[model samples]
Target: MLTCAVPTTLGPVIGAEQGHVRAFKGVPFAMARRFAKATPPLAWTEPRRCTDYGPYAPQPGQLDQPEDSCLSLNIWTPVGADGPLPVLFFIHGGAFVTGGGADYDGTFLAAHGPAVIVTINYRLGPLGFLQLHRHGLSEADNLAISDALAALDWVHANIANFGGDPDQVTLSGQSAGASMVIALATLPQARGKFTRALALSAPGRNIMSADHADHIARRVLAELEIEQDPSAIASVPLPNLFAAVERVGRRIADETEAGTVFGPVLDGSVIPREPRDVFADGTLRDVELWLGSCRDEMVMFLKSTPPAAMIRTSERNLRVAFGDAGWERLLACYRGSVRPDENPYEALLSDAFWHRPMADLARSHAEAGGAVWLSRFDHRPALEPFLSQGPTHGADNACLWAHLPDFIDRPILKRKGGPMMPADIDVAARFQTSLLRFVTSGMPDVAEAWPRFEPHRESLAIFGQPFQVVPLNEGARSRLWAELSA
Candidate 1:
């Protein structure tokens, strides 16, 4: 592998080059003590080797025994470019708990689009999202979001040396990361940081109210037996802290039927207001937006659920989300619309959690005069793991990255192992090309065929074998939500 060095704001860093793409891994953007706000890493006069990934945030069941100094980012840039290229800043999604930037290899996308690609690692689980301001630890709340802001600030100040254009950055993320993208786009601090945003499979209701966050924090403190001395939480052992987080998280999921217990909180300081309201109120009117979700988003969560338990939980959650009168009507609509092999409850939850919210956000952005594009990933790879179910959560990653080996080799998307079919390559090429166009330009189409998602038309591009554009479906489920909200 060829070696090179780029001078960043801190100092010079060594990276590895392979063919047309150069990769810089594990470059620390910021550092922080346990549960404290992150600060810039100490400057190094020597050429630091950034050829390998850095440590990830401490969380339950992580392999690397995560460290507090996990605020690092990886960069992939093309070898030969005439001028500065657009930047695609991505955040990985493991429900805001178990993922790091190392999981995503942006070399392919960087080489294909010839655009700079960046992925970051941030604090996670209780260490990242736990609310501690009420307990006198004001700086500890929303540490993960602060970590992200620091990373972005680093890129804006330093990406030009890596052949990336600082003015044309596209902020993008998936799942929990997608929610962070939404939060960052609406944040006053994140203004002028990026020109465009792309969010995939962002949960509709992931942001916790202040009361809900305080309640969860109290539960965590009590679990650790530190309710009396909340400051002692900083000294708790890693194992004990993670154990408390898991127990409290599971109990909350059981009670709320929500998949995650940790997420961005409306702390009135970091995230001042609801993100949905920000979208509707035209706060992001100047930023371009692209949003997407898989067809069967909830199947990944419900696949392991027992039939009786799944039914009971889904019904109860639906009742709570849509109230009694709207729940029955929504259930009937899903039963009539879902496929024979599909579960109605899963479909309803998928819409409630991912699809509906994405569509609504896109519509609101468009209505607010922001340019928007909407899409749904419908191409199900001809793999054994996905044979029974349609395109489930995280299925789009395999195609988007154009690397099927990662998906087949690992248990991601429930794949034990499988051969890469011809369709996989074809779909991956199409997906990557469209995304490349979007990254380079504001538009997401190779040709002028794909239409913008206007409020009246609400055109949605379906990413299937023969990529096509169609109107967004506002069926009985959407109507029910609209009526209930009204």
Candidate 2:
């Protein structure tokens, strides 16, 4: 095995979880909970162990409790900054509920062509979303967005020392993380933080609206038994404050909270307003964007929702979520074509929340005069149809970073008895090549002379059984989009 030498910046970071080495973890970039004026962290010294992954930021309750000083970053650099290298900044997805940088390893990303890969840890759920109210402690409702901005700022200043070019930064993420990247493009604080952004499986308003956002902060404050004032709420103890978040999670899905106990707050501080509106109005940074979604993006969520509840979900709600024109268009495309369903609420949720938002976010960025690159991860899975979901979440993991077995264990996935087939390994190489090309030259489809996306005219790189450049499926896209945005 190739042993990893310690870097000057990081003494050495090690993990024995099978073929894992030459990778570093848990380096603090910013002060813990620094975004909020209220919360603080446990202290640490230079060269913090970082051998093991850090604890995740707070969640509402049970299952587990992350340590207080969990705000940190993990990095993988293939080589030194001998020359200017492309940069990929990663954000994790959790619906503001679960997930952390610890869940992913950047070795694949670092080895994918030439670039520096960075994954960050941010506050989640109540620790991130609950607002500061009129009465008591641990206020500052807009913690999630604030945490993201601070992490990016840390990268912009420090990535160069690790062989990454601050100017050529590419923001990459999936699910809620993808939504956060799209949101970052529009925030004044994150302005110039990255030159390019890629979103996979984003749900719109993962960015959010002012009133709905404000309510989150107010609710957090109310939990502390304080109302009307945010300052006092900010003073509460961090542990006490996090406990309330756990309490809310028990009945979030059915409650007024919509099962989302924590997320970006439209508190007018970290995040100014709805990201869709900002992009639509051209207030965003005007950077290049690459966005796409899988065809069966929601099977994961569907399998998890109670089967009995399936009977109760209102398709009309789906229509309202998407809108009339969108519904008709979707009905035309989805109905006649594939995935015909007795009822498609689960599919609707996927498109309405994840797929359409990413597409529109790309188009809006493109409409603002910035370049755009789009795609449909139509690749079929060797696994069961439901598991892979064409371009499901983590679908791109192998593609963008191939040779999983090369530097670490489990990079090359295997079944109990079947040999690991490189079925999509070649596709992953193509994806890595295209992504490398995009990061290096800002064009994932340089060969297509792939045109930029416009509100009136859209183009996409379809990645599936037979990869090809085709006009985006507008008929299917628009209707699904309209329904969700409605």
Q: Across residues 1-486, which tens digit of lDDT does each residue of candidate 2 receive?
A: 333433333233332222322345776554444235323233343444555666667554422544346677777776433546778888887776667786666676566546777888777765665554322344454666666776787778767666678898888887778878877777887777888888777754474455554555566666777665556644566566666555544434444423354555555666667777787776653567788777656655565545222212333445554566756666565555455432355555566656656677777777777777777676644443323445555566434543532212221122121122465655655676777777777888665456667767777777765677777655554554555556
Error of 2 at 205 (Å): 2.7
User: What TM-score, over all chains together, does every model reach?
Assistant: 0.93, 0.78
TM-score of model number 1:
0.93
Q: For candidate 1, give the lDDT.
A: 0.81
Deviation in Å, model 2, residue 352 alpha carbon: 2.7
Model 1 regions lying over 4 Å from their true place: 63-66, 138-140, 256-260, 305-317, 382-388, 404-419, 446-448, 474-486
| Candidate 2, run of 10 with poorest lDDT | 410-419
> Considering every candidate listed, which one attains the maximal TM-score?
1
lDDT of each: 0.81, 0.61
